[model samples]
Structures are given as C-alpha cells and as structure tokens.
Target: MRVLMRQSAFALILSGLATPGALAAGSHLVSSQKLDWETATKLASEAVRICAAQGYSVTAAVVDPSGHQQAVVKGDTVPLQSLSVSYRKAYTAFSYGQAFDKNTTSELINAKLAGPENGALNTIPEVLFVPGGVTLRKADHRVIGGLGVSGAPGGDKDEACAKDAVAELQGEFQ
Candidate 1:
C-alpha cells in the first residue's frame, strides 16, 4: 500500500498536478539580454582596430552572458595563443560580472584582489583574474555580455582596447 501511494504521488508531481504545499516554495525567475552575433562581431572588430591603432597586434573576443563566445577577431601578426587568452578573458568577465552583480570586470578583480579573498579566485578554472576584460551592460545596469583583448604588451593596454570597443557601442545598447 505504501509503495502504491509513493508511485501515485510521484506520478502526480510529474504531471504537475501536485498541490502548492506539496511542492517546494519560492522560485526565482531571471531575465537577461543576449548579445547577438552581429553586435559581437562588430565589437570584436572594433577592439582589434583599437589595439592596432596603438601598434599592437591583438586578438579580441566577445562572449554572451553565459560565457559562450559569440565572436572573435585576430589581428595580423598576433600570436596563436592570443585566441585562447582572449576567450578566457571574455569568459572570466562574464562569469565574474554575473557572480558579483557588477557592471565591470575590472572593478571586481580589483576588489577581490584587495580583499581577503586575494588569490582565491584563481582556483576556478578558466577564470583569469587579469585585466583586459570588461563587461557590457544595458541602460538599466543589466550585464549583457563581455569583451576581452589579448596579445598587447600589457594587460592594461588590452583592457584599454576592450573599453574602447564597449564605448563605441554604448549608444546601441539601449
């Protein structure tokens, strides 16, 4: 009799016929904007151009909120390793931005490094706590994606290129 009752309850739950009290309470609904392919490609191209203007052959990557690469652009003479670095930077930005609820990855890095959590963030896979990564946010402060640049002489220089790319598309984010 008990086994039959358990089976019936499982069936009811599977069919979405369970009562409110029988189900777990409290659920969250999340909504976020996605960075389309067109915008991602444009952003990556602009970032590469920005670095090139400074005489740096760099690679740029754009990633959506889920840390998936949307587009990547490699400048001439850039090292092959830059492609992976750029993707990791972009993924780190998106992951950290979402985790901290911040609009910028640089700020998150700074805060995390200065606080007691210094060096702890590096334990996470594919999370580079370096500069050169920035978050893309909408007008309402919702993060939509991230942009990263690699292959420059310094991480700061790469970060500058990523920032310029985001600034260029700031008007379109609305």
Candidate 2:
C-alpha cells in the first residue's frame, strides 16, 4: 500500500513538472460572462408587456446558460403551470443553443430533434421543446441565457413576445 502511494505521488510530481503550464495560476482560472439580475428582470417584464399589448396574458422566464432561472414575470390569471413551463422553455432554448450555434427559437423549433431519434430530450425535467424561447447573447454572440414566454394564444405568439423583448433590450444584454 505504501509503495503504491509513493509511486502515485511521484507520478503526479513528474506529470506536473512535464506540464509546467498546468501549474500556472492563469491556467487554473477561467472567466465568463453571466446574465445579471437587472437584465434578466427587464427581459421578463418586457416579454410579458409585449404579449399583454397583443391581448394575451403570459408568463415570462429568464434562465442562465445552465438552465437556472434568473427572473420571472407572470401576468394576472395566467395558468399556474405557466410559470414552470416558461422556465422550462427558457432552459430548453439555452440548452439547444449550446448544442447548435444558433440560439433563436425558430431554428430550434425547426431542428430535426423532434423525431424519435432525439425525442428522449423531452424526458429531462427542465427542458421544454416549445417555441417561446430565445437566447440572450453577448455582443460576440456567446449565449449567456434564455428568455421564454408562455400562455399566449399560441407558441408563435409567445415566441414573438420573447423576440420583441430581446430586440428592445439587446443594448443592455452585454
């Protein structure tokens, strides 16, 4: 047992020396942008407002790239399930945005993943393949989060609200 431990320790030391760059502080640190609370809140509110103007009550949710909710807004009398569905839609948008280069809901809805070949994706608790979701991106086009709107008359209406919200606040997304 002692021999194995010593050999493992020696191997680790030799590997560290062989790759000196791995020991550098910069190599251990990574930097990435995340969606801020203010921006997320603005997105959710704007989506709901846009849908309201079209005579539809809706719930909007914003989620980080990892599918965690950042903010949510629900209009009066929207179905209680709308909250969860909105968040899931946002999560699905972000997830597929990572899988595909494009983050727009139109691209996602048209993707071939709906077939049985990838239909298992729906089994995941946080993913909803519906069309109300859009990605939030940095200026360089890196997706930082997603926005989803639910409870509109149809998925298309919900998608329009989400896209309109993003188009309005894109300046702040960075």
- The candidate scoring highest on TM-score is 2
| CA deviation > 4 Å runs, candidate 1 | 1-31, 113-118
Q: Candidate 2: where are CA atoms >4 Å away?
A: 1-25, 115-118
Counting only residues 3 or more apart in sequence or on different chains, how many pairs clash (N, Cα, C under 3 Å) in candidate 1?
0
**Residue-level lDDT tens digits of model 2 in 99-152:** 676576667768755436666878877877888989778786767788989998
TM-score of 2: 0.81
Residue-level error in angstroms, candidate 1, position 62: 0.7
Top-scoring candidate (lDDT): 2
lDDT of 1 by residue, 49-140 (tens): 99999999999998886678889999999999899888888887776776576545577766764135566667677778778888777786
In candidate 2 the C-alpha lDDT for residue 78 amounts to: 95
What would you estimate as the lDDT of candidate 2?
Answer: 0.79
